[model samples]
Target: MQYNANSPAEYIRQVPAERKPAMEKLRERIKKNLPSGFEETMSYGMIGYVVPHSIFPSGYHCDPKLPLPFMSIASQKNFIAVYHMGIYTMPALMDWFVNEYRAHYKAKLDMGKSCMRFKKPGDIPYDLIGDLASKISVQEWIDFYQNSIKR
Candidate 1:
């Protein structure tokens, strides 16, 4: 599940063939729907969408050298995972996603604090994920992070 990739395309290329289409579609949804100012890259070994240093020069508080990670999609050992920092930091966003997910899918939601795991790639909710990606803007995220998450 750990791919030694240098870029998003490289990371997608390393995904298992069976899951490649799902990964590609997932990436496409995020890219198309995410608000302006987010950049696509490889972060934490997955395909990540981030607020680059040009937008927020302070960088991530955990690692000042790294950009502020907003979202990431990864092909894990047993599932495809989507990590969204906004849902983790903002309770309203989390609640909205939870309610919306129930409305969209019959399957039970498999989620963690910040990671949503889909055991079957075909079951992934691409539109719902796209909506989630569009929910936060760069400035909103930066403001929220500064007010609520930074230590």
Candidate 2:
């Protein structure tokens, strides 16, 4: 969970050998389906997909230097984690994702508000995850973030 990598490549190299393949596959799926404007980088000691500073000048409210995080993939001490901010912020989207996952995967989702923890590659709902990644555009996320702050 300690992310020391200065780059995405370095982050991949740092993942434990046992968990490397699954992490790589998950990363690939996200990248392939990720909406335009998000950039991949090392953030919070994980591989983060974020709205770059150029797209959202204010950056993340929590930390200006860091980009607005959209999603992240990390090899944790106990499991691989996929974090999706879009679903966490929107109740409707969260409901849709949960329904889709239940229908297709037929297993209980090991998840928090934004984080999906997987014990192995098979535990992931790859197609659904990719769709979720593509659900929101950068502008939408920025708007949502800004709106949330005003309330």
lDDT of each: 0.95, 0.89
Per-residue lDDT over 34-144 for candidate 2, one digit per residue giving the tens place of the 0 to 100 score? 989999998898899999999999988888888999999888988899998987889999999988998889667899999999887678888888899899998999999
Worst 10 residues of 1 by lDDT: 142-151
Per-residue lDDT of candidate 1, residues 1-151 (tens digit)? 7999999999999999999999999999999999999999989989999999999999899999999999999999999999999988889999999999999898889999999999999789999999999999999999988887546
C-alpha RMSD of each candidate structure in angstroms: 1.0, 1.1
Model 1 bad stretches (over 4 Å): 149-151
lDDT of 1 at 45: 88
